[model samples]
Target: MSLIVRVAARGDGITADGRHAASAAPGDTLTDTGEVIPGPHHQPPPCRHFPECGGCQLQHLDDDSYAAFVADRIATALAAQGIEADLRPTALSPPRTRRRATLHAEGGLIGFTEQASHRIVDMRECHVLHPALFVLVGPLRALVQRLRPKGRVELHLTLADQGVDLLVKATLPPGLAAAEAITAFAQAHALARLSIDEGYGPEARWEPQPVTVTLGGTPVALPSAAFLQATAEGEAALVAAVREATAGAATVADLFAGLGTFALALPAKVYAAEGARDAHLALKAASAQRPLFTEHRDLFRRPLTVAELDRFDAIVLDPPRAGAREQIAKIEAAKTPRLAYVSCNPSSFARDAKALCEGGWRLDWVQPVGQFRWSTHVELAARFSR
Candidate 1:
């Protein structure tokens, strides 16, 4: 028998001899015949959809082992880039804390897609979603039934200050009858807001009051399909790390600033730039009274040049999964004195870190964040100083 050693980047278990096993957890043993024997770190998955639903992949791992796996992912990414830094302890978000998620509705079922398949898992219970968000699953299913939506429908749910904000993308257009049913459903559930996308952009069907999400201690109007951190705890962890990294800076540039996650939180005079129009406007409106400057610019298409970047005392950027390659190039050229990088994908982060390091910046430390718990996803906040 071979012992399962670690979980790979895609959630598959790797054995001692380097063979991958599906649905195997660390400490589990694989027989020569390919049967898996559960070990100490293995536990019964809390969700019945486990091993089938694509929502979670590491639920079989114990708490300690799961945390280790999350840290290892970051370590491996840095190692690949030949970049070493002091790695802080991994911060794992507790279950039932996920504030935003996208579920699929198709074939009379609504839930996450099945692992390695396009079929929906038809979620009966979700351990990761906040109770507020999960409670609407049944109501949404009922609404789908009433509307009899054809083909596949995508549902995006996020917890706002008022309540759950839902956006539905349906293949079939909602007629008068379907629209009435959606409105009734939203009213019955007391939803904060409900919108549907029928080829065009999302059109609000019900909104009793304004929908907003409080970020950096301020309430910003929530826009449909706007970017947000997955969990509140995870967002707090990242914010704390960023604050520590850029403490005492008088001026800070927040590139790729989505709705002012770091811009509004930082004490410095912030200059926030984002490509998304809605997010930029939301941040601008929320930061009108604060010492924050918001700009609607595409960083990738036209990254802030060295001259433009030199105006800030410190830089903090949270780019998408692809990482801020273009912006990091400018930052490298500028030799920014201080930088705090928040990333959801470690591979791209490491790649960018190498560029910064080669440009004479030191990779100080990284705070690993396991926001999407029980999954291969890894996020981190790192400090770079020249």
Candidate 2:
């Protein structure tokens, strides 16, 4: 028998003697013929849809092993770039804490899609969704049957300041009669807002009040289409890390600042730049009372040049999965003293980190944030100084 040494970046288990085993955790025993025997680090998955549901991947790993997985992912990525830092303890968000999610609907069923397939799981019970969000699953199932959505439909559910904000995107446009049914569903569910997209854009069908998401003690108007961190706990951890990384900087630049997640949280005179019109407008309106400036600039097309990058004491970048390749190159050229980078993709982040380190910047530390609990998807905040 061989011992499962570690979990791979793609959620598979690797044995010491060069073998991959599915559904096996660290410390598990692997038989010669490929039977996985659970060990100390292995535990029963909390969700009934384990190994089938695509929403979560590491549910079988205990908390300790799961935290190790989060840390190891970052370590592995940094190692590839010939870089290392003070890897801090990983912050694991508790189960049932996810406040924002995208669920699929088909054939009167509502749930996450299956792993590596187009099929839906038709979730009967979920362990990762918050109590408030999961409460509407049954109602949503019935509503889908009534609406009879043609083709695949996507339901974007987010917990706004008022209540659950739901956006339904379906192939069939809502007719006048369907509008009535949608309104009724929204009202019955006490939803904060509801919108529908028919390939055009999201049009609000029901909104009793303007939906806003409170960040940094200010309520920023959450546009129908906006991005937010997966879980509140994860957001808190990331915010704390960024704040610590950029502490004492009087002037800061928040690039790709979606709804001022890090810009508003920092007390410095922040110059927040965002590409999306709604997000830029919302951040401008929300931070009118604070020492913050807003700019609707697309970093991908036109990154801040070295001359422009030298205007801040520190910069905070929270780029998308693609990472901020262009911005990092500018940073390399500029004389910016420090920066705190928040990234959702480790491989992309590692590439950026390599450039930063090669440019004479020092990687101080890294803090991993596993917001999507039991999932292989990882996020982190890091500090770099020159």
Candidate 3:
């Protein structure tokens, strides 16, 4: 029998001899008969959809084991680039803390997609979603049934200040009856807001008041399909790291600033840049009384040049999954003294870290964050100084 020593990046268990076993947890043993002997690290998955639903993969592992998996993922990514840093203790968000999620509905089945398949799991209970979000599952199902969508529909749910903000992506066009039914559903649920997306972008069907998400101690209007952190605790963890990383900086530039998550919270005067028109406007509106400047610019295509970057004493950037190669290049050439990089993907973060390291910036430390708990996804915030 071979012992499952560790977990791979994709949630597969790796044996001592480097054999990958599906659905195997660390400390489990693989027998010659192709069976897995459950180990101490293996815990009964809370969700019955485990091994089927694609939403979660590491639920079978104990809390300690899961934290190690999250830390190891960042360590492995850094090792790949021959970069070393002080890897801090992993911060794992508690179960039932997820505030944002996207669910699929089709043929009266509404839930996440099946593992490696397109079929929906018809979720009865979700262990990851916040109690507020989970309660809306039934209401969403009723809305889908009333719409009678010919094909699959997507439901994007986010917990807002008032209540859950529900967005339904329907396949067919909504008629008079469908619209009335949706309006009633919103009022019955007392949802913060409800919007529907046909072929074009999402349009508000029912909103008693303006929809807003409080970030950095301020309420910012939440545009349709707005990007937000997965969990509240996770957002706090990331924000704390950013604050510590940029402490004492007089002026800071927040790139890819969505609704001023870090800009408004920082103590220094912040110049925030965002590409989305709605997000940019929301940030601008929210920063009216603060010393925060807002700009709408696509950082990927036209990253701040070295001259533009030099205006700030420090910088903070949270780019998408692909990472900010272009922006990092300019930072490397600039005289910015400090940087706080928050990333959702470790591989890309390490790649960008390599560039900064080679360009004279020191990789101070990295704080691993598990926003999407019971899953293989990883997020981190790091500090870089020149």
lDDT of each candidate versus the true structure: 0.90, 0.93, 0.91
What TM-score does prediction 2 earn?
0.98
| TM-scores for the candidates | 0.97, 0.98, 0.98
- Give candidate 1 misplaced runs (Cα > 4 Å): 172-174
Give the range of the ten consecutive residues with the poorest summed lDDT in model 3.
Answer: 170-179
For model 2, how does the per-residue alpha-carbon lDDT over 1-386 read when each residue is reduced to its tens digit?
Answer: 99999999989999988899998999999999999999999999888898899999999899999999999999999999898889999999999999999999989878999999889999999999998899999999888888787888899999999999999989654578777889999999899999998889999989998999999889999998589999999999999999998999999999999999999899799999999999999999999899999999999999998988898899999999999998889998778899999999999999999999899999999999999999999999999998
Count of clashing pairs, candidate 3:
0
For model 3, which pairs clash?
none
Clashing pairs in 1: none
Q: How well is each residue in 52-142 modelled by candidate 3, as lDDT tens digits? A: 9999998899988899999899999999999988999989999999999999997778899987889999989999999998898877787
Off by over 4 Å in 3: 172-174
2 versus 3: better lDDT goes to: 2
lDDT of 1 at 31: 91
